[model samples]
Target: MVIVDDHALLAESLELALNFEGYDARRVELPEEPPSETKLVSLITRSQPRIVLLDLDLGQHGSGVRLIAPLARAGVDVVVVTSSTDEPDWGHALHAGARTVLSKTMPLGEILGTVRRLNHGLSVLDVEDRERLIRAWMGQEQRIIEIRRRLDQLSPRESQVLEHLMGGLTVGEIAKLRVVSEATVRTQVKSVLAKLGVSSQIAAVSIAHQADWRAA
Candidate 1:
């Protein structure tokens, strides 16, 4: 596993902590000194770490969130470690396909547990966080149902497209996986977005994410 943070001290501490837990951890300080994105990617790819511990607030200039899709595409799991209790951050992290979101304020044991759970293909969120997400999901699910009812929409293909969308699959990736043309996938995505009355893929996915569609 790898840990990325702007704070060198925190990275060192986490390196020791994770090593103690048998993670074979390495630490990287994502300071402004790093001049190239290619360098960071090369470092991470060379390390071939199974997971990355990222800090959302990387000293105001960088975003660990932006690394989510790239790392995930590289077959790595990102577990965000931050002190922010903001709902939007949590949603963004989840929407970006983070394996887990852990608060820095949480107990060490809880953090460890979350890490273990995520490594096992499970997600970990605080109870309160889960409740809040569920409530938001219920509202969104109602909205989706209403929209679908009104439009008499969501054919099997469209629904499949929506499922892939919710799973964070890009149009190109989905097309390749489904053995279809990118244009076809793009059209299906647009149709689903129009039917749901949502203007963006992220918003459509966010609704399904909060609704716990896959979890259920």
Candidate 2:
């Protein structure tokens, strides 16, 4: 088995423990400066482990989630062992053809037990749970599409005003910051509210939070 993760200490520890348990496991640390996807995939494929354990967050290397599809396509049994509790992340992994997603919070013994089961050609993940996560991921994707449609209705300046509102600014405050009149700011705020389909600033901000919007 091969472990691909950026947390060197944790990866090394897991590797040592798995080896001690009589399983041939090794750690492949994701470097801070990551290589292109093609090179990265090539390196992983060369190792040719029976099973590949991966982390979703690969530090500056960004999400290793995208690797799931290609690795699975190459006939690698990709097991995701991650710290992320987000259902959408789990769902995304399942959609990308991962064998299963396991939490790091699960006891090492339990994790190893699952690996043993996989080696023996037994089912590891529950079908119901897997289906649930896939549904959550699909729902999350739909919500993002809808949110984009709403926000995309805003003019460029309205987008800026929405960002300012999310930053905890009042209309008057935004006017001063943008060197505009109070009436102009209020008009823009009204337009933002209308475009976002929210009657209040609080609701509009909630939408931004859901979209993980950042001020530009």
Candidate 3:
């Protein structure tokens, strides 16, 4: 087994525990920048480990979400061990092909059991975490639907204006882009805010970000 986490103490502790349980375990420090897909495949090949216990947040380096799919493709199971309470992180990790997402707060015994189950090709999520992940996915879907509905209420020009706003354009910048007067752009901005039920450009932008409206 290999553990990939930024925190040295936690990695060392987990290494100790796994070794005590008679498994060959080691901690592989994450690079400052995440490795390329080919490099990652090479590392996994070299490690020849059955499971990878990964952490998403690697301080300045960034997320481990990008590692999951490649590891899965390489036939190495990934168990996401994170302290993040945000549902999207969990959802994203699972969607990217993690074996299971485990809270850092879970007991070591439970974590060990999860690892063992993965080694034996069994699903390890508890019923509660499964339901929570489902709820989180449902909530995200509903939010996207709502955002889409609100966006549908906009005129084509208004939709264009909202996209610019979410892209961090000022009223003046947007007006220049649309070849319209600043006043006209401001009017469209107000219309967008009203339709989206937001009070300001920042609020509207926040909604846009949450809904991933730019992608739409």
Top candidate on lDDT is 2
lDDT of each: 0.74, 0.88, 0.83
lDDT of 2 at 38: 77
Cα-based TM-score, every candidate: 0.55, 0.90, 0.69
Ranking by lDDT: 2, 3, 1
Candidate 3 lDDT at 102 equals: 87
Which model, 1 or 2, shows the larger lDDT? 2
**Superior by lDDT: candidate 2 or candidate 3:** 2
For 1-216, candidate 3 gives per-residue lDDT tens digits of: 999888898889889999999899998865667676578556655768889999988776568888888888888888999999888679778877787898888888888888888887887877687667757866887887898789779888888898888888999999898898999999989999999988999988888887767633
Candidate 2 vs. true structure, TM-score: 0.90
Candidate 1 segments exceeding 4 Å error: 125-216
Backbone clash count for every predicted candidate, in the order shown: 0, 0, 0
Error of 1 at 41 (Å): 2.9
lDDT of 2 by residue, 35-87 (tens): 99877877787878878889999878779888999998888888999999999
Candidate 2, superposed: residue stretches over 4 Å from native: 166-170, 199-202, 212-216
RMSD of 2: 2.0
User: Stretches of candidate 3 above 4 Å error?
Assistant: 126-135, 138-189, 195-202, 211-216
Candidate number that wins on TM-score, 1 or 2: 2
